[model samples]
Target: MSALGMQSSILVGGFQYWDSRRKGRQFPARGDLDPLIDIPRLVPHIILIDVRHDPLDFRFRLIGSAVRRNLARDYVGHWFSEFPNYSASSNIWPRHCAVAESGRPMLQRPTYVGPNKDFIYVENILLPLSVDNPGWSMQMMFLEFISKRH
Candidate 1:
């Protein structure tokens, strides 16, 4: 069960759309993602992550406008592990690993720790992405960070 207070229909809808694309496969590929240009309201809240491995890294691929503003910074091109959320032994790390390993979606509540240890209560969803010829290099993923703050 999710610890989130109230779910956003937009987030739920986006997950459903991505889930639908799987069609019994491991996960939805990047090519299968919708443009999201159709939903202007959601554009600023969505985030995309790349599930990289070797040491199991999660890279920030896209940091939406609203999230960027809420976070007071953008992390695109940066590694999720650098942040407190994905730090070793953190609740979020294991759940994210589960999603990467099982190729399933996981909804988890994690307190995001920014620089200076500022904590933001957030609900995050993790999804896998793969290509026909699945490999780490092509293993993209999705993550939605819905902050309860602000």
Candidate 2:
């Protein structure tokens, strides 16, 4: 929340929703996530990434409506490499891998967008979700754009 200032209620709210369902586990399982119940009003700000390690792939499981609207693109079922000249993906993908490796939630705030169609700021909250075994299979991302007004 540095340059972006305090965490927006949307982010806090998302965290609360995610944490409440944690039940003391390292991370919540993908099945535990119910979009309608977990983030009822922030669908556009949410994203789900399917993680793979055999060849290291990060594919989009879901893309929030808001993201599609703001980016003017729908990345569902696409990997970051599928899009070229997109700097944000380059910056974000590594952190995602880190979260998967650590099996912990990671935060990257005040993510400045550099003239990518429009100037914007976003905060990335990546929560690792595991289906079975000890490796993470899903990355529940709350990619929230902080209001530029503040």
Candidate 3:
């Protein structure tokens, strides 16, 4: 619900949709999310990540069209550590780790440093998805682009 403070309606709607799916649980189950029926408009900006333990790695489960276009590549089956042009020091890796460990939602505005330099910034929200698990196993990310570099 705190996502209301966000300037982007898409993010707000996405968060609200996620909140609605909780249904008294700490987090929603990944299977409960039906983007096509519920938040169709937000699908283009959505990304699904699978949280891997052991060494605490993250793998892309799904990537929306807008995200693929922005990155200029499709990373559906790639790990975060293998992101092109990004080293292990990338902030995204740690952020995903924190969300998985904390079982909490995170809203962030990160400077655009991806393959698409034309982007100025990105406003995104990461929501944890748990299914009868002690910790989150999956995460749903909704990103909203702010401005252009020009």
Candidate 4:
């Protein structure tokens, strides 16, 4: 199994507690809740994709503006290959695929290269979203800064 596969398994197993806690609360649909109400509650930079599609064709359906600003562009609807480096795509896509395929979540700390190739550490949560569609197309992601100084 890939490193991401191992991480996905661990995250899924650990999520039992998280799910239970969430169930105890009442979180409405995204449309029903205020967009800015709990930005911190869900880390915003993480990327989610529709696993049923080719990773090269997979689009990010949801993204936070904070993430967009950090990225400096609209990454939603873009392919992972479009990222600055092939290393970034290779490092992230497999783990993303592992979680989506297993209906599990994966925690990843990815480094993004900023201006002048400065690396920024982003802690991310990749959550699988099971929709009724036959293709099983969807995933949710959350991201936060592990170190602002990065």
RMSD of each: 4.3, 3.7, 2.6, 6.9
Clashing pairs in 3: none
Ranking by TM-score: 3, 2, 1, 4
Quote the positional error of residue 134 for candidate 2 in Å: 8.7
For candidate 3, the lDDT comes to: 0.81
TM-score for each predicted model, relative to the true structure: 0.72, 0.80, 0.87, 0.61
- Could you say which candidate leads in lDDT? 3
- The count of residue-pair clashes in candidate 2 stands at 1
Q: Please give, for residues 49-122, the per-residue lDDT of candidate 4 as tens digits.
A: 65455423356666875466666566677766667443245666677667656756566777765442343666
Global local distance difference test of model 4: 0.52
Which of 1 and 4 is the better model by lDDT?
A: 1
Candidate number with the higher TM-score (1 or 4): 1
Model 3, stretches more than 4 Å misplaced? 84-88, 115-117, 131-136
User: What's the lDDT for candidate 1?
Assistant: 0.62
Clashes of each: 0, 1, 0, 1
Candidate 1 residue-wise lDDT, 32-132, digit = tens: 76646544566676777776677778777886676676564678998767977556567766776777788767665656654424445565555677755
Q: Candidate 4: where are CA atoms >4 Å away?
A: 1-48, 53-57, 81-89, 115-119, 148-150
Candidate 4's displacement at residue 85, Å, is 4.2
Candidate 3 residues 1-150, lDDT tens each?
Answer: 653367678788888899899998888898888998888888999999887776677788898888778875778998887874433587677788788888888888888766766678899899999755543388999998776743
